[model samples]
Target: MKGILSGFLVVVHLMVISQTSPTDFLFPAPPNQKELTSQKLWSTQYYIHQFQSGGKIPIVYADGKPSGLFADTCDFCMASLEGTAFVKDSSGNSTIINFAKSGDSSFVNCRACKRFAASKLNVESWGRTLWSKSQGFGDGVKNYRLVPFRTIAVDKEVIPYGTVLYIPAARGKKILLPDGEEAVHDGYFFAGDTGGAIKKNHIDIFTGIYEGNPFPEVIKSNENKTVDAFIITDQTIVDALAGLHLKKAF
Candidate 1:
C-alpha cells in the first residue's frame, strides 16, 4: 500500500511538469519589464526618401543610359544622406535608384530597372554610375535595406543593431500602411540601420517616402521631442516585432 501511494505521487509530479509551459522558464521577462523608463528616452529626428514623379530631373548610368525620372527639386536631396530614390517614369512605373561614386564624381543607378530612357525636355541629370563596390543602395553603416516606419538609424555604440525598442509617445499615432490603409502606431521600432548624423542619445526615424512633405506629420510631431523609450530584451516580443522588419527586408 505504501509503495502504491508513492508511485501515484510520482506520476502526478511528472504530469504537472509535463503540462507546464516551456516558455515560462525558457523566456524570462526583460529587466525593464517592457515599461518605459526616463533613462531610455532619447531625442529623435526623421528622415525620408521619395518616390518622385512627373518632373524634369534626369539621371543616367555611367554609360549614359537613361536611368529614371525624378522630381526637379530632388536633385540635391537625392544626392544627399538619403542615398536612395524611387523614380517613376511617364508611364507611372517606378524604379529604385541607388547612389554610387565614380572616381571624384557622384551618380545614381537604376539597378532595378535598366531600360528607361531620358526625358528629352531639358531634364537635369542627377548623377551617373557604373555600379561599383565603392557605394551601395542601403543604409549608411550596415547597408541593411531600409524599411520605412519600422527602421531607425541609431548610434551603434549606444543602441546596437538588432535591438528592439519601443517609443511610448508614438503610441496610438496613425500611419499610412503600404497597402494605402491607415494603421495605428504600435510604438515599436527596430535599430537595423545607422547614419553619420546619428549620435549618442539621438535617433533618426525613417518615414519612408513622400512627394511634398518628406516627413509625415505623425513623425514630424515627434521631431526634437525627448520621448519615452524602452529597450525590449524579451526574446518573444522582440522576435515578433523585429522579425517583422528583418523578414520583409532585403
Candidate 2:
C-alpha cells in the first residue's frame, strides 16, 4: 500500500545517510583533491623546556664568498627567504627570475603558483642537508655520514652525545615553501655532533649543505621552531645511528 512504500523510501534514505563518510564534516574537497603523507605528532607544551633556536645555510655570493671559512673560523652570512620565481619571457627559452628578500624591489610577492612548493617536491627530503666549511668534520673521510640530520649536535650536559631522539610533528601552520608548498617536521635525529653555539638546552640540527644548491627549505623550516622530542631508548634505533662499536654517552 501507500504507507508501505513511504516506509521503504525512508529506510533507503537512512541507509544512504549512514553510508556517508564522516570526513565530509572535516575536509570537503572539490572535484580533484590531494593530500600529504602521514607524519608523527609532537606536543610543544610537554617536550619543550627552553627557548628554541634556528640554524642556517649561508648565502654564498659568487667569487667573493664569506671570510675565514677555512681552518678554524667561520664568516658565512646566512638568511631565510621564500623566493618567488617568475618566467619573464616565454620565447625559445624561459628566462626565470626569482624575487626574494635580497632581490630587487619590483617583482616582490608575485608567484607562478599558490602553494607551489608543497607538492611532491618533498620538503622533508632535505634531510641530509648542510653547508660545512672546507676543512670541517668529514672533509677528509672517504664516506662520512656524520654531518647532517644523522649527526645533530646537542648539549652534552643536557642530552649527551650518541643519544637518539624521535621528534614528532608539531601542530602549527604548515611551513610553506616559496611557492606555497607546506610541510611539518617528524623524524629521528642523533646526538653526535657539537659546536660552540650549541650549549645547554640548545640542539643544533644539521641539514648538510649542497654546494651549488644549499637546502634553504629545510633551513627555513627548522629555524628556531620548538617541537616535542622523545628520547629514543630503543637500542635498535640507537645502534643504527651510533654504529656497531659506538656507545651512547647517556
Candidate 3:
C-alpha cells in the first residue's frame, strides 16, 4: 500500500507539472478566437480578493480580444504571428501575422519555457503594471500581454514564470485606502514575464503600458507599495490557464 501511494503521488505530481508546463494551443481563426470571453471561462475557477493600490484592476478587454501576447519563443525578442509561422522573435523589427478563418495553428518558440511555482515570486516593485516599451522589452513589433493577466516579474526561486494567479475580488468587498479613498479588491493575473529587479518577496507587475502612451500617474508612482494577492495552486486552475494560454477563443 505504501508503494502504491508513492506511485500515485508521483503520477499526480507528473500530471500537475505537465499541465503547468507550456503547451501550445492553435489559434488560426483570430476573429473567432477574439470572440472568446473570460467571463464564461472564469465563472467558476477564479474568486479571490485583490488588495492592491488605488485604481480598479485593469479591465479585461470587453471585445474578447486578448492583450495580444504571443510567447517569445526566443526570450523577449520581437515575435509575431505571420500566416502560420512565428518569426522575428529576436529582433526589434515589426511584422504582421494573419490568421484566416480556416483555423490553422502554428507553434511559437519560447526562450524561457518553464512550469508553475509553489512559492511567492520574489520580485521588488511597488506593484505597478507596464507594457512592452516601458518595461524595456521593445513593443514596436507585436506588442502583446501574452499571459492573459497583467504581467509581472517573478523570482524564479519562488514562483516560476508562467504560473497563473487567480486574484479574486470579494463578492462585492471594497477596501478603503489610507488616503481616504476606496479601492476594490479584484483581478486575475498571471506570471508570464520576468525581470532583474525582481527579488525575494517582491513582484514587479507589468502594466503593459508604454512610456509615451497615456497611463495613470499612480501606476508609475511608488504610492502603492505592497498589494495583497491570492495565488492559485490548484491543478484545475493551472489547467484552465494552460488551456487559455496563446489560444484565441474559449
Candidate 4:
C-alpha cells in the first residue's frame, strides 16, 4: 500500500510540473530580455505601405488631368513631424498650451498608396512565364492583376526604413542601443496621433475597417498584429539631385 501510494504521488507531481511549465512552441524565450528598454532620445512617427492586389495600372495626374502613366506613390505624399508648445504655470504646474496646432505628425495620402509600375509589370511577366512553361500562356496570363497597397507612418530614426522589424506586443521593451547605456529605442516603429497616448519612446499604430480592397484592408487590419517589417528611408542614400536642390533651393 505504501509503495502504490508513493507512485501515485509521483505521478501527480509530474502532472503538475508539466502543466506549470511554459510551452516551448507557444511562448519561446527571448534571446536577451535585459537588453531591452523604452528610454529614447528622439521619437517620431512615419508612414507604412502595404501591397495587396496585382494588375490594375495606377493613374497619374498632369495639370489636374489623368496622364495615363504610373506614378510612384511616395513621390508626392510626404511625411514629417509637427511642432507643439508646452506651457507651465508659476506654481510649478504644467499643461499643454495649444490643441489646435496639434496635427497628424505622421500620415499618408491616397496618392502615396498607389502601386508601382515595376512590381505590376514584373508580376504579369512572371505569370506569363509560368503559364507558358506549364499549361498555356493565354489561359494563365488572362488572370494577371496589378498589385495595390496601403501605407502608414511609424518612427524613422529608431527603425530604419527598408529593414524588416518585428513588434512583439502592442507594447514591449524595445531594444535600443545594444549597450543599453544611452537613451534610445530599437524595435518596430508605429504610427501615433498628436493627442494619443504617446510615450517618450513609444508609438501607437492605427487600424480600422475600410473598403474591401485587400491592399488598404491589410494595412488597417495590421493594428496590434505582430509583424517583422522592412522599412525604407529616403535620407540614407546620397543623391546628386538632392545635393543640387539643397544648394539651389536655399
User: Backbone collision count in every prediction?
Assistant: 1, 13, 21, 24
Give, for candidate 1, the lowest lDDT window spanning 10 residues.
16-25
Error of 1 at 156 (Å): 0.7
Q: Score every model by TM-score.
A: 0.57, 0.34, 0.31, 0.20
Q: Over the stretch 61-163, how does candidate 4's per-residue lDDT look in tens digits?
A: 2123332222223322211111111112233222211112212222223223444333322222111110011110001011211000111223444532222
Candidate structures ordered by lDDT, highest first: 1, 2, 3, 4
Q: Which stretches of candidate 1 lie over 4 Å from their true place?
A: 1-48, 51-73, 99-103, 106-143, 210-225, 247-250
Return the top candidate by TM-score: 1
Residue-level error in angstroms, candidate 2, position 145: 5.6
Q: Is candidate 1 or candidate 4 better by lDDT?
A: 1
Of 1 and 4, the candidate ahead on TM-score is: 1
**All candidates' lDDT scores?**
0.49, 0.31, 0.30, 0.23
Residue 28 of model 1: what lDDT?
A: 29
Task: For candidate 2, write residues 1-250 as lDDT tens digits.
Answer: 1333333233323322111112211211121212222222211100001101112322222233432111101111111111111111113121111111232222111122243333443222122122232212121112223332345656678777777665543222132221223333335566765543445556555432211112232323332644545676556656655651132211
Position 174, candidate 1: lDDT: 60
Candidate 3 lDDT, 5-107, residue by residue in tens: 3333333233222222112221112222233332211111110011111122221122334334333222211211111111122232222222222212223
- Supply candidate 4's per-residue lDDT for 19: 17
Q: lDDT per residue, candidate 1, 1-250, as tens digits?
A: 1333333233323322112121212232245644544334454444434443545545555455666454544433443345555444556444445555332354343221232234221112233322211211234344345555667778889888887776656655666533344656666677877655567767777655422222343344333646657787667777754544543333
TM-score of 3: 0.31
